[model samples]
Target chain A: MTNAQGADKPLVLVVDDYQDAREMYAEYLEFSGFRVAQAQNGAEALEKAFALLPDVILMDLSLPIIDGWEATRRLKSDERTRAIPVVALTGHAMAGQATGDQQVSCDAFVIKPCLPDALVAEVRRVLAARKASAAR
Target chain B: MPSTAPLTPPAAPGSEARTESEPLSADRERALLWRLVDAVTDPCFFTGLEGRLLIANASARQLFVADEASNAGRRRAVELNQRLLDTALASLATGGASAVRRRDLSLVDPVEGTDLLFELVSTPVQEPGCTPGVVCVLRNMTDLGRATRALGESYRRLRASEQQARSERLRLDLILDSVADPILLTDPAGGTVLMNDPAERLFAAPHDSGEATRRRARTNDAHLSSFLSHLLSPGNARRWRGELPLVEPGTGAPMPMEAVASKVLSDQGETISIVTLLHDRTEALEKARLLEQLRAASNKLEAKVHAATAELAEQNEKLRRQAFQLEQASAAKSQFLANMSHEFRTPLNAILGYTNMLLQGVSGEMTPQQRRNLQRIDSNGRHLLQVINEILDITRIEAGRMPLNAADFELPELLQEVMAEMDPIVARTKLAVHTALAPQLPPVHGDRQKVKQIVLNLLSNALKFTHEGSVQVSADSAPATSTVSISVKDTGIGIAAEHLEKIFEDFQQVDSSPTRAYGGTGLGLSICRRLATMMGGSVAVQSTPGQGSTFTLHLPRRMRQA
Candidate 1:
């Protein structure tokens, strides 16, 4: 259901290497009543994330140029996009887990081949958690 | 006073008829005496007390005469006769009561021209009142004197030889006693005829003790019997030597003795006695025994070393083979994982993602039939991805490359989470899902994600198999044993008794036929079992033919902390 957000729709940046996955994520987010922008690789994702200052970022960790891990690090470090939440999307099952000494900086993780509705639901949950923490 | 009785009346050479009563004048008497002296075989003469030759018989004159013409031509005969008359007169003067004397005289006979040995006798002669005269008689004795001298020489030589033989016997006795080795000389009958000082000491008993002597004798007797038996054997060599055991007589200790026996032969080539020399061999035998033992020990050590070396070589070969096999299996596993991730999962992700978008109405407007078809495509794609993931999980476990990310998580919470995840599938089925959780259950210590996966797989299996009956899950912790058990029970088409164990094998399904109703890659139970094992837990099943099956996962309360 595409609710009528008018001009106040929250923008979401979708990053993935595969064009079909990126297009599908963009179409689903648009139809779900959100303004969506897409990047084919992590470098473009970082550019778009900073330029758009999206409310939430959907990141595919296996991106080309700069991987999602580095892009997420850059986005979180910059004050302009630091407030935006990142939800990691990856084909690797354990990519979301903290690896070695570095914690997974993203706010959420979803395995690839995930249901569209389920990915959308996770995105909304992370945005709400971020809002709650900010209010606290 | 002068006695006129004549000792014997002289017989005249011409008169054969003058009887013993006939008296004759001095001249006739003198002539008769001269004829008598001349007729005697011995040479005889008559000398006056003044040492003058008064008369000489024809025998004496014949002994002195070389030739009748030479006698008258040489006056040397008269001088020799006068010297003989003086010696006779000296002998008569020195005469004792019988007025007779004898002496040995050597003379050269002028007639034979050789030295002569003679014994001369002088007898006193008395005339009616005239001076005394001597009658000298001379006898030949050359052969008798030579025989007497030869007899005295033989007597002296015999005495010297006898003394030499006595000393030789004494020297031989000293030599025999000086030897240290026991030597025994035995008669042919094997009696102890003679023994040296050493042998005597070897065989001697305690002196003055009769019993000791008897004991010594008995021991010696035994030794003697053995010795004789060997020596008296018919074909024994003339000289033989060997070792023999004997008991020491005084000490009664056993002794190893070496005896060398030789047959003593007489001049006639007959066996006289046996001479045996004995030496002690106790030390030598002991040395030989030690040497033999050392050789055996060294041989055993060598054999053990050889066996150990062979075993080590075999172990090294086995390790090499195992290492090679491990290398090959690891390479195959890595290649498979790479292919699954790139060649299979990537495309499968696109399929599921696109189908998900279509079902979500991201692709234009869709009719009811299009929605149903898209849902089918979405579900099927998810199913295929699950199968690929299961295969990869089992392959990683088998290759021992599946690293466990262990953490502490409550079992009840994990179970509820898994149940919530399975809600959609369970809602589609008629079977009701239930839970039996022990209160205040302890947290399980294992790989949280893998444990969650295991529980989800079990619950999914339960929902998939059950048609009408309920699926029950139970979890309990046993603090005493530090273990926890989670059970999943389903009342559906149950597995046969025989297939219970086979179900957990790779790609094995209860109904394995191509046309079988169940849809699966048949690697679910295999992955569950492998994951449980990796978490130091085990998966077991209990089932009846048409009733139900209960699959349980038992894990230690605390895993080894990494």
Candidate 2:
């Protein structure tokens, strides 16, 4: 959803299981002059991620139907949605770090109850990294 | 013809004398016969063919004493002599020329009063153209008969003894052969005098060749010589027994033997020979060796079992320690997460976030009442942050993750700063605040920030508990110790005796009832206790119901330099 300055704004996708957290993040991102889309679960997030094709995806790790880990894997595996930078939001700060023999594949990780500004900053940083790698 | 007149007429007798009418040769023969008959010790007599007694020798005259004196007066005697003469004459008649008759007779001797046994012989004497006569002789035989009887008894006893000796010898031979052990009897010269069947079989020649037989003989000779020498030696025991290793004469193989050797002694105490008894010990020795091997194996197994049991015990101890450590780590992790999650932080984040957005006019301008409500949310969010910070501090202390920032700091000055910062809280309560500091109070050592936090926590707890009385803060150097103690005392609602100890535990308060009106995260006193303990110090509380509570923070005067 966008305000009056819609066409010029960069689009952002926000996904979270908690409605209050999702609304807060989406409100903040929209207020910061960005078009935003929201999905309450990972499945809906994946559908909209492909349908909307937003510039960045803010994904909560814990979701209903499909978890953020599998959704992210699917998104990265699909050639059409592979370019979208996905930032993992989790209650566990070290969720994106490798555990045992498993390597968590994510562009960025943000701890839960994070500052809105910090989350926004992490999204921009991952988008820039994606662009740099794509340019290469 | 010249004839010898009767030199002595018939001295006694029923005999008649005849005139000398024989030839000179015949007269000489008659004279010789008369001399021979007179010299004999046996009784002898000559009688005429007509049954008259011609002549008798002296022994006969003595036998017929009654007839010697009176021939015609003793008619009974004459008759008895006549009967004897008749017997003699009858023998002459039966054998016309030469007849001999013999009889055994028992007679009682009148002189000796003893019975006499005699043999009588009658011989006929006849000459051509001469009257024939019979001569009788008596021979005694008592001594000869007694000698024969004695001799027969001796012979019978000798025969019986000989039979007994033969039987005993046979019995000894049977016993020797029946024994399984080899036995040998040797002479003093080391020659084999006798051996049992077992010994002979044991030492039998190999049946191979003369060479083998010769070899066996040599071995036996050597063994016998050794046995005899040892037995006869002066220093050797009379009976010697021991294990002997011998080479088998036949097989020429080594064999173990149990041997006993003893000297045989004669009745005169002379050494007659030596006897050696031997048993083959090959099987017994094999059995002993096997038993030793089994015992060694059993000992090794026992040692292995002991080592395994010790190793198992050590492993169990190690596992138990590791499990305990893992449980401790897990508990620490849970406490850390609980402290971090607090949940107040998450909500505060949203409350503050939304409130800031509203205040900053992110959506649009807000009404006045809305602004005030937003400000109240901001204040409460900040209060929750403080409580969250307290929780974090305690978690760090308990986790041993909090680092000390030690430096020298003035105690009075620090306390003054703490009281000044507490001015707002203190202003809200109707309680008075006081501070007491020693005149020469020393600057304490240890974590400066943590010490500041400890003082702030204590002061706040005092203010929060006391409603109508003054709260006193005091600092002094503990006597006889290298420590500084800061104490906070309040006179508000006094802690119950039971709650005094509970106040310093995490999430515990004197009055934990939600509606009882004291507001706190209940972590202040616990954090103070933990922080003090981390600084090598401790906190103590003293309280009485209806009186008030005093909490003391004791810190080391000089922190350890790292």
Candidate 3:
């Protein structure tokens, strides 16, 4: 969660209201060689994200106040935070599609508790894409 | 008559008085005769053979001439006198000349009109060598005649009164006969004194012979004996009601009757008669029998109705129990589906994640064939995961537990993205794709994820269900009402009428042929509908059986300006 965490070995923030999910995602991210930060809700995630400024955020859409949709908007709108990528986490895949359909800006949608490797790959891809944009 | 003591009768031994009274003084003889006549209460009279009045005492003159002057001019009196005189003369001419005669002797007095009496003792008197002289003596016996007349009048009145009483009895008997009901009257001793013809007929017998009547009378008397006994028990004055059986004299058959009796009394308070009335009870008995039958039938019907109601209640109870069991089973199935989805996905997440990490060389490098094989494994796994996800989505929706993440999101942006995503698929099918986004659309409060799922599912359906026709995605917003409608219209193989409703059901496809040229779990539309609802919106589809299909999503827009 510190700025020293490189873009390739980026720090990843995992936000979910479910305790099991937060643990699961943190384990998966750590195994994938990314420094992992975990929050139980959008509010916690926002506070943590400021301190961490992680490369990518994996946010559960159903989180309490400052849900994934609003959190993504806030992150995208901030100058210091605009470069970070946000991906949606959901239980029902159909519901995840609905979030994309409403144009609540997020880099991608993934159903939870998703396969660890698929989630890590998404994290690494988005981080690499952000690093490429930042180099530009 | 100084010489009366000097001479006695010449031939008389016990004739002293005769000799002493010989040549007696005329004054003395005349005095003796007068004394004898005056001594009798009856008026005395003597008559000569020539029927001339010879001698009469003062009594005779008073009685005989009592009405002679007073009744002389009356015709009835004269006739009465002549009849009296003829009867007296006729009696005297008979050889014995002794008879009792009753005659109406007239008296001319207004107070005493006539007189009648019985006369007796008339004898003839004769002298030597001289014609016999007839002498008649009269006696007044009018008082005896008056007594006889009074006795005769009393006997006649008694006979007339008896006749009137008998006739009155006959009148009552006739009245009793005219009525249909039997009637009888009993004597104070409870013996049958009078019975009407109906009563006689009811207990039938011959009526002609007096002997037979007497015999019947005895039998009736015997039956009445008990009645009298009951009445004598200080209950005679009280109205006695009872059932009695009168047997026919000849047939010996019982005639049942309901009887009511009362005691009739004379002025002296002595019971003169016991009167009874009878009513036949056959009809009443028959009516009672019929009523009993009707009551039994009604009771049977009531039992049947009760049984039918019991059966209906039992059936209803069974139906309710079945419905409750189905609901419980359905709920359990939904819970199982949700739990399985979460559990299954948890492990699958690791498999897919590890694969992705390997493919991206986050772990290490891999050969070209290994990478290609890994890609295939990932692709196929992804496809299988999509199917599993669809199954979970359909189950959750059916269980009514799908969550909605509502917020303010742009409908136009959502629509444009859907069209853009569907454009590649449309290009592959060589079909034209079109878009219409309403100008300056308002944001809507909805679950963005669910809304996007609906749009993606609908746009995919348009591309998949169509072969070569154009696909159109349209968006319109009501600025005044803050509502947005998004639609995907396609010139595709339209749904059959029967399949339109079926298409929205989980895992339901139009046909079951595996080679039917379409591949799916048939859960796309169902998921789309559920997602739309979760976003506080709805999804509807219209299709002609042979034309194309249009799917529309409606959402309530949020007032971003407000």
- In candidate 2, the residue pairs with backbone N, CA or C atoms under 3 Å apart (3 or more residues apart, or in different chains) clash, namely none
Task: Tell me the deviation in Å of residue A81 in model 3.
Answer: 25
Model 2 C-alpha lDDT per residue in residues B243-319, reported as the tens digit of each score: 66666665767767788888888997667887889888988889999999999999999999999999999999999
* lDDT of candidate model 1 versus the reference: 0.76
Once superposed on the true structure, which residue ranges of model 3 sit more than 4 Å away at CA?
A1-111, A115-136, B1-184, B188-202, B205-237, B242-259, B264-324, B363-376, B405-410, B420-427, B437-449, B476-485, B527-540, B553-562
What's the lDDT for residue B440 in model 1?
Answer: 86
Q: What tens-digit string does per-residue lDDT give for candidate 1 at A1-136?
A: 1233566888888888888777777777777778888887989998888777888999988878999998989888898988899998877653444574235578887877676677889988998898899999
Q: What are the candidates' interface root-mean-square deviations?
A: 2.6, 3.4, 4.5
lDDT of 2 by residue, A1-136 (tens): 5343566677888988878778888898887777899998989999999898888999888789999888888998899898888888875432334353223457777765576777777877887887799899
lDDT of each: 0.76, 0.74, 0.69
RMSD in angstroms between candidate 1 and the native structure over all alpha carbons: 20.8
Query: Model 3, B1-562: lDDT tens per residue?
Result: 0112111112222323556636856655655566567566665655556544455565544443333345554445444443465456665566453443333333332235654464544556677885465544555556767788888988888889888888887887789898777777777654577778877665435666455554654565456455556765654455677776555444444445677877787898777777777777666756887888888898899889888889888988888898888888998887777667776776566567667667867667999999999999887777778887888877777776666655777877776776677666666788888888868777777677777788888888788888877888888987676678888899888988778889888777787577877777888988887676665567888998657999898776742210
Per residue, candidate 1 scores C-alpha lDDT tens digits across B150-211 of: 77777777777778777876776678888767788888887888888877766765577577
- What proportion of true contacts does candidate 1 retain? 0.55
Candidate 2 local accuracy as lDDT?
0.74
Worst 10 residues of 1 chain B by lDDT: B1-10
Model 2 chain A: lowest-lDDT 10 consecutive positions = A93-102
- Which number leads on lDDT? 1
